[model samples]
Target: MPFILTRITRDGLSRLMAKYVVGQIVCHERGWMDTHMKQIKKDCIGWHTFHSFRSLDQLTVGVMGLGKIGLTTAKVLKGFGCRVHGLVRTPRSHSSVEPFVDQLWHGREGLADFLKDCDYLVNLMPSTPLTHGLLGDEVLTGASRRPVIVNVGRGDIITEADLLKALEQGWIFAAVLDCYEKEPIPEDSFLWTHPRVVMTPHNSYNNNEDYKRHHIQTEFIVNFENFLAGQPLTGEVDWQTGY
Candidate 1:
C-alpha cells in the first residue's frame, strides 16, 4: 500500500445530499465500518436507495409515448414520488392519464427539450413506418444530460445503428433494452459488450393468457350486441394506418 495517497476533505456539500452515497458509513470501534463524515461530494448519478434519488423527490421522469403501458408507468412512478411528464402528439385528449403527466410535448424536436430535465426516459412508442429508427442520432443529438433509458416497446422504433451510436457517443446514460432490431442479438453485437446496457427478450408486457377466453367472449358479446341492435361494428380496422 502506498502511504503517499492524498486524502482531501471539505464542507462545501454534505454527503447525505448526494444521490449515490446513502447516509454515512458509521464507524464502530468493534468490527467498525470505519465511518467518518466529511463533505467531499463529487456527483451522484444512477443512485437508487433509501437516501438516493429512488424516492423520486425532485426527480423528472419522461415517457416517450402515451400508450397503455406508458401512461400506467408514469402514473405508478408519480404515486411513488417522481414528477412525470409524457411526450404525446400535440392536442392530447383529457383523461386520467393527462393528470398524471406534469407536462406534455409533441413531435421529434419537442422530444429534445422534453427530455432535457428527465432523469429517466421510458420509450413506449410503437414501431410504425414513420417510427422505424426514430431514436437515431438526429433526436439523440445535443441531449443536455444523459438519462437512463428503458425500452419496453418495439425494437425497430430505435435502429441498431442509432442505438449503437447513442451508447458509444454517450447520448443516453444507460439503457434497459427488452427488445432490439434483431430478436436474437448476435453474439458479436455491441449491446452484448456495452457495460451500461441491459438486454432481455421482449416480454415486459406479457399478455394475460388466462383471460384469452374472456377476451374472446367479451369481444364477441360487444360485437354480438351491436349486431342485434343493427348498429355499426366498433373497432373497425384502419386500412390506411394498418391497425
Candidate 2:
C-alpha cells in the first residue's frame, strides 16, 4: 500500500452534499417550480391549484448504494426527520449504516421488498457491468409506493427507454436525474419536456462554496498530514475494490 501514492479530494463531500440537495428538491417537489411560475403568471389571482405534499418525517428514503456517499446522505436525511434505508448485496455489518439506517435490503432478491414502501429513492452507485439496466421494468414495476427516483448515480443503471415507460405508466412518482447515459442529453430527448422530471447537467456535485472554501485541496492536505503522522488517513482508496 505504501508503494502507491494517492490523494483524497472532495469526492465524499460533493456526493454527500449532492444527496442532501437532491433529497430536499425531491421531497419538497421543487421540480414543478417552472410550471408553478407559469400558472402564477397566467392568472394574477383567480386560478389556483394546490398540491398535496407530505413532510419528510412521513416518508422513508431508500439509498440504493450503501457506500460513503450514500451513508453520509442517509445520516444527513436522519437529521431532517426522515427514515433512511439502504440496499445491500448481503447482510453485512457496516459502521456507516449502523448509526444512519436500520432497514436494509439485500441484492436482487431483496430489491423489490426494499422498494415496496419507500417514498423516495436515492442512487449513488457507479456504472458497472453488473449494474447495467439494474432498474429495469421488473424493478420499477415492483415499486408499489410510486417513489421518487433521485439518481445521482450513473444513468446507465436505469435505461432511458424503461424509465420513460415507467414514467408514462406512473410506476414511479417522478425522477430527479443528475446523470444520464448521454452526457449532454440530446436536444430532442423527451426528458427535456417531461413535466414530472427535473434534469441537471451532471452538475449535482458542484457547489460554488467548494471553490471558495478550497475544500478539495483541504481534504488532500489533511489526509497527507495524517499519512505523514502515521495516523489513519481518511478516504484511502482500496486498490482491490477500486473504490
Residue-level lDDT of model 2, residues 172-236, one tens digit each, is 98888888978789888889999878787777666687563687778778877888899987767
**What TM-score do all the candidates reach, one by one?**
0.66, 0.80
- lDDT of candidate 1 over 1-243, digit per residue (tens): 322111111211111112111111111111121111112232234122123223455567787777555666666667656788778654565464667788888766577778778767777776667567767765776566676677766788777788778878888777777778887888888888677676656655333565534554566677668778977665544444433
TM-score leader: 2
Candidate 2, 29: how far from true, in Å?
3.6
Who wins the lDDT comparison?
Answer: 2
lDDT of each: 0.60, 0.75
RMSD versus native structure for model 1: 16.8
Clashing pairs in 2: none
Residue 191 local lDDT, model 2: 91
**Number of clashing residue pairs, candidate 1:** 0
Off by over 4 Å in 1: 1-53, 93-97, 207-237
- Any residue pairs clashing in model 1, and if so which? none
